[model samples]
Target: MTKQKGKLGLTARIFIGMVLGFALGLALHGFAPDSSFTASCLTLFQIGGKLFVASLKMLVVPLVFVSLVCGTCSLSDPTKLGRLGVKAIGLYLITTALAITLAITLAVLVKPGIGLELHSDASFKASAAPSLADVITNLVPSNPIQAMAQGNMLQIIVFAVLFGVAIALSGKAGERIAKVFEDFNEVIMKLVTILMNLAPYGVFCLMAKLFADKGLDTLGSLGKYFFLVLGVLAIHAFISYPVLLKLLARLSPLMFLRKMRDTALFAFSTASSNATLPVTLETVTKKLGVNNSIASFTVPLGATINMDGTAIMQGVATVFIAQVYGIDLSLTDYLMVILTATLASVGTAGVPGVGLIMLAMVLNQVHLPVEGIGLIMGVDRLLDMTRTAVNVTGDAMVTLVVAKSEGELDEGRFNDPNAAKAEEEVHLPHGHA
Candidate 1:
């Protein structure tokens, strides 16, 4: 069957691949005990999934640079930029703080990590995180291209805005460059479409391998804690985001969520907000009707710094760790967890093993043993999915908030029920949206 008029849509085909891969993984893990088959299947899944992600990432630099340049240069008033910036950052901070608080509240009320006697012999060595001052200092990149190559979303964004501003000031010459950026944006989005089509299979492979190895028993041991973390994420995704979409942007939350499945799926599979940057921007722009001027800037910054989901993980993990060690944190320690996790959102945004690193900071702040982190890593992938989903949703939320403040968002697109599906139809080879 052709790509068009096929019996099954891309989403359906991907869903099938995911289910089949998962069943195969479970069979290999439990029933078969066939080492060769297991190794071959895992290798196939890894290579295919990695290739799709790499293909998506290949467009990130061009997509972010060009889209951001276009977005910034089009802003005739720099005041709008400042306003939108404040709104986006402010929302992010508030959400991160709220995320941790929700986590703490849930852990206390539900006590998910209580009564667990599992062998928690996991070694945890957390790299020291940068200070807040250091985070600010590092945002100003010495070399813009280096930032882009490094996938430093914050620094790249800072550089893109500056370059865009210079073009905005250059009169006709700047317009020429802006036109080039616009064309680049279109091409990059086409690549995003291509990548999105492969999402179901990618998600399946990632999840199947994750579950097959870890098994449901790992989750059973920390059932309360696991459920608590996941519950908080659900609340944040379903309640927090929808409210913002409705109240601030006058958009339909359902429409946005429906449209976001592909981007969220990509984020869940990759578990890296930076990897999902291109897809997020595309969803916000083409799917959610967010203006590129607002989306390009806000989406990148949000991905880098607005980690509400990760913050929730930190908060819940801190509480769970303390409980496991029989450590009773003082009021001051709880407050410190809130502060540290919120700030760590920005500090460790691009780092690998960020969730673990941020949890270490929280654990230290509350005088809990950092070794407690080992207990949770067994099911980290499951938690990471919920976290990444919240991350992408938070990105979209902040984008809308910024766009509304800038009068840049298109309400018609935000309201359309089909807006989200429209993003998937366009051929995007890079797995962007």
Candidate 2:
């Protein structure tokens, strides 16, 4: 399909939206300072952005369950599923470990928390973390419908895989059911296409409201902690992921990043990996050329478990909090922090405010006061957005590596600049609602 006259691509449009939104937000914050009109505009911005985020999130559970069921049932060998799981989870753990270690090394060198007062009225009550046995037992949902209702991703994934595997084993009956699922998958993807067309506007509102309220002011007293987190996130995204892409998948990192622009923007705007899963899955299978079989399994699982960005934040925050309290961490303490933060990534999966909770766990491991979490909470919103972008990028990177290892990657589509360009600009048929 040819490009429509005078219309920008989705990536370009989203970028424009973000830039314009940022400018408008900063302008409002600087000039209005306090005004009824400004408040109204911010309110409108918030509503618009939230609606977009909700729309994206609306697709996640169904998309994951449906797409994964389709992908799993199509597999020719059931054992390949186990191998795929092993590779994806192993890579996730390694990258998360690397992320925290990098954060700690950078933080120790920068000393972002040095000389800062440990005083704060910011108290935090950490929710008790579940044991490994609980996490493992909870993986098998007793009621799949209840799991779906609760948006319990791990449970949904487990149920979908088993259902798909059963379909694969059911012979003629399996084939008929699988056909129905395949049809449903297409419908779900069309829904995704409809959502993608709305993304630029959604992205604009999200950026505008975010900057309007949060503009540059939250950095005071926490500037070092804030930027260090951002810096490590960038390194993880630009440096670390690229190296892995090149080394493991032998794919061009530049091409991967270029293809990832839209998904990364969506992840950053929404600050939820689950919300970004539809876009990420689309980009992987369509633009990046990972077979749906692998992309389907890996993307949703990665969304749940792959939190390199959060791990990085926890790492830096642990060191920062320890330093603020003048508690010098021994070498063993630093090692413990890395191990705890990495494992906590999986252990605390799907919890609300998981980054802080994981940081609290890490803090306790090193005997640092948990209340120090309040010191860095003020600046977390912006950093959360950036790190989420990093998290999704890591997900895609691992997906590519695993897909390539399994011989499921299509290098032609991956290498082509315009592989999914026209597909992204979906238009409804005339007279269609």
Candidate 3:
């Protein structure tokens, strides 16, 4: 325990790396554009960014597998998994719809779509959305291995719950399986700790590379639209989440936020919720003191389904693209945009380059130019980070809500401002033990 708590935790070091790397990136880009500098800076960028992401990815498969299995078996009654599923999906839908509504409402008032040049010449064809039949069929993978290979969250979830229930019902046989899984969970979690030790170097590189390539000018041109989306996300995160966590969950949002910063920064830098999954899982379980059972099940589902941030982006982008192309969308078109974005949030969420897909769907609905997606892709690298930050926030928020409803949340740790310290006490010594 002394060894565990004596040093700065992985999160603190990684944060320091990110800040230093980001500053170095800006400095290199601004003051040293020469070939040698560029070459040297690229090395720094790769060290901080690529390595961090790769290390994180290394944790993904193990983390998800172990955490999900453990989360599944820990349920008091395996049947409650069904109830948890319902609550999580329901909360996700309500929040997603609310998010888009808020974003669209703000867009209309802000008029972000008005007076933008709508480029018609760029030919961008959108892939057809899968039919409802296909969506349903894809949910239950016949081969679970194939599902994991595909990183299909919904299918992975269905299988994990089923596996756990099977174990729960089998008496002694279930105990044998559960014990094996528990050991595997420990092994995988240890792998996560090993990867975490490399976080500082990875974070430093990723942050530096991002600010170096992505300039403030990207935001300057679309400043209004940017702020509209940003403001909506911020309001939802700071204002909406606090009220819910404080009132409904009866926890201190300030304490939650302080503990959440390390994972939040990782999400902001990586821009992939899936990529951020390992860290998110660790943070929620260890720092926030959410039950591993809840964190494992809810966090992945949240990454896949709780796309309030993406829904908001789709809402604003639909308006922005419509105005850029001089397309005058009526009430029906706006309504369609809302419905389409809300639905697509679930379908296209785990898809890489989801922004393009969502934008494609929105443009097709409003008869805006599909190629308008390219206009935003340059700045999207940064915006992706922001949206991801919101996405994870939604994930943690919903997890807290469901945990509270089930009487699973650790209110004592959650209310303490130094929740991270409590987390170290719970998880750190366990590892050594």
Candidate 4:
């Protein structure tokens, strides 16, 4: 640990990368708007950023599968898994519902979309949402290999839980396999540590490419709507979550957020919960003092289903779209939008572009134009990044709550300011450099 003395922590370094990247991107965009050199630099930035995100994503499948299996079999009581699932899913849905409700109420009061004189020739074709029967049917995978290859998270979750239960019942053979899985999980976490050490460069490239491609101009045209969504996201992440954490789990929200800084930054830069899963898992378990048994299971499930931030966007967008087209929606319509958006979060789990797809389903249910999505698509990349941070925060919040309820949390480690200092620093052994 002496090797890391006086060195900047990973979180501080990542923050520096973000700030410098943003400044550099703005410089390139403002000064070299039409230069071929600028184009080349942007291309390199995009490639570097995508490569970093891909590296993180490469660990997701094995991390989720192996970690979940190990967590599952470690439980002495198989029935506790059922209880954990209930609490986790229940909390997720409740928060999602609350998110959309807060969004709609605020949107209706704030009127973010009124008096907008903008016109767009843009149109979007929304894919059909799956039926309830179809969603239930697809939960159990016929071929787990195909599920893993395709990164079908819900199916992988179901299979992992069932496989773990089977292993629990298999006596000594099960114990041997479980031990092997535990070792594999440790190896996978080490890989995560390796990737995290490289996160500053990755985050720099991602933010640089984003700002270089789509700068603040995108937010100018839809300033009111953009900021409204952003405000609600902030309120949810800062206010709503903390209140719930303080109330139900009786935990310190301040400490939780402090510990979550690195994970939140990762989520923001990558803008994909699945890609950020390894870091999130590490944060929840190592830094936040949650048991691996709980973190492994809930983090993956939350990534797949807990989309409070997306739900907030859907809520605000529904009201914004209705007002933009001069359509007056009644109270019942607003209530329906709330209900539809909340349920649709789970109904369309694991689908690509799920946020907009869920938004389309909400719009269709409320008789709004599905094409209205195109209007907000301009500013969505930035909002997507912000909302992803909120989404992962929700995941960890619920994980901590569940872990606490089950007497699985280490409050001492959580409260300690330097709980995971050694884990956070990346240092090579002597003479390696």
Candidate 5:
């Protein structure tokens, strides 16, 4: 492995790419609104951006399955998995509830949608949400292969955990298979490293296309909603997460935040938690010094279940939509919103357009017009990016706490400012190293 301390770190490079892409996109949107050159460049950016996102997603299934298997097999006491799951999921749910509560309180006080006249003609039709029974029944996959093929994370998680438990119970043969899984995990992580090295270009392309298509005019029209969502997201990331880390994990919140910059940037650029999984796993294990056993389990499960940021959006949007429609929500209605939104986080796991879908469920529960979804849909893309950053922050925070409680965390690495940067060095082949 060769360390290049003088070179710019990945976080700095990605940030630079984002700024340059935004400037370039803005220039084209302003000066060459309908030019063929702009269209061509935008097309190329779209292709690069899509390819990069697909590449990252391509790693999620194998990485999660293999890594989780390795982690489970490493356990000396199987009961510890039960304890770990309880702590991780409990922390995640608590944070989700807190996020939504904060968001609703802020949105109610600010009144972003009051006195605003948006087009009432816009209609939104929400898909039928599965009942709680359906959700629970569907968790156990009928076929693990089908689950993997469909990218059904909850089902895949169920299958992986059960399969891992089996492997752990099989004694000598289980140990041999576990060793093989460990090798697969190593290879998958190396693949993540290779893809991450390409993230600057991907982030640039994604941001350029995003800004080019949705210019400042769209943001201007929905400035209040935009800023409110952003403010809440910032509060959760900077304040909520840090306080939790300090109070529960007893680690330096500053160090944890410092290690998270690159991972958060990836989430913002991609705007998909599943797509950001590989980078998150790498960051949690290699940088934060969480053992792979705990990181593998907590991070993947958190991506599927913990959506504090999305919960925050739903809380704010529910209030904003109700205000826009001139409807007053009773205290009971607000309670229902909090309950629905918190449960919806797990209910909507692995579903596409998760934030909007959850918002629809909340609106329907409160007898609010579902069509009001259109009012906020225009700015959802921008807000989605910020919320995703918060979601991953929650994931990392929970991973640290779980790891610490289990005695699986390395405090030195957690406190090191240069931990992530040092780990980013490119490792060469055996002869070269």
Candidate 6:
């Protein structure tokens, strides 16, 4: 018992940080109100929180590029890459389509927006979505360095895969380069380990600032809309993913969920798929027993393209906003929403404010007033966090399925509760454990 309680593990520490930070934020909002002192304190917290998120972002591009290169180079059969990509991407699109369909069906039945009359003076102007031609053209980077500089994940993935394939096809020279990439991969993962140790403080600051600024009123004002989205997200994460995992991968859903606790918390706190990529990569490969070859490719691509949680929000929010505005969508319009959102998952990859951006596109397609988005924007931050958790969960689920299909999954490591614990001890600095 004493050994168990001797030190706080990463997951427990992070949960405590989140709970304390939320309580602190609520107390400040309720007691301090508009005090200058509260304002100053929150400003400090925001800086610290943003910095921590930035630190994570700094690792994303290099980690994805190098890890991907390493994984690709290690692949002896080049044909496997093509097959793997097809399966991983196909599953992502199917699941996303399913998610939006579920959301729309539930929204139409529940009618969360039927009677509520909401008027917003605020306006939303969506950035122009790229044409299909433009999206396809941009897939192959004109300049790989520029893609990395801009953090264009899809383009980066393309270049890394191609570059790694070239290295794999090359002779002795390729072998040397592959060795260098493997070394880089190891170093970068160690850096991820270091950053994770700081996560408690980062999670604390982020939650504190968010709750301090937004408070509970935002949720209260949009209770129906908020809960509807939350319910759909919960269903997708808990039901949809587990069902697929059990049927397709023959894996234990309970074990998958148990291992996901730490990764899910990271996603919830960050609310950016890109920001969560490093941790997701670590968890899927290290903790979940997915081979790096499969995880390295699927996880990053999933982060770039998969938006199941966002699709759910788009479906429910579209219906909610339409009902609020007294605009009824036809069956055709509903189909269009599903189509538009599913395609937009890929179309809007790497775009900033992706959920709202895709929502704008869907509204335009269905001829709903785009400005209605302003009505629900207030509570989006919270919903974004929840949806992000779902998104990463989907990422892991797909990784498991694909790995299992390819015979890349390690059942022994995956089924062992002590797998990740033992790995962490191995990776720990000398004298730490």
Clashes of each: 15, 0, 8, 0, 0, 0
lDDT tens readout by residue for model 6, 75-171: 9899999999999999999999999999999999999987775785769988887765777789999999999999999899999999999999999
- TM per prediction: 0.93, 0.96, 0.90, 0.96, 0.96, 0.96
Could you tell which candidate, 3 or 6, scores higher by lDDT?
A: 6
The C-alpha RMSD in Å for every predicted model, in order, reads 3.1, 1.9, 3.6, 1.9, 2.4, 2.2
lDDT of each: 0.79, 0.90, 0.77, 0.89, 0.88, 0.90
Q: Model 3, 279-361: lDDT tens per residue?
A: 78777876777888888898988888778788888888877777777667788988888887777777755433576776787
Model 3 ranges off by over 4 Å: 1-12, 34-36, 121-132, 350-352, 420-433
Reference-based TM-score, model 2: 0.96
CA lDDT, candidate 4, residue 145: 100
Worst 10 residues of 6 by lDDT: 421-430
lDDT of 5 by residue, 1-433 (tens): 2335438778888998899889888888888978999999999999999999999999999999999888887888999999999999899999999999999999999999987888678778888766667778999999999999999888888888888889999989998999899999888888888888788899999989988877787787678988998999999999999999999989988888888998999999998889999999999998899998899899999999899999999999998988888899998999899988888888765323678987888899999999999888888888888898889989999999999999999888777777767557555578763
List the pairs of residues colliding in candidate 2: none
At residue 377, give the lDDT of candidate 5.
81
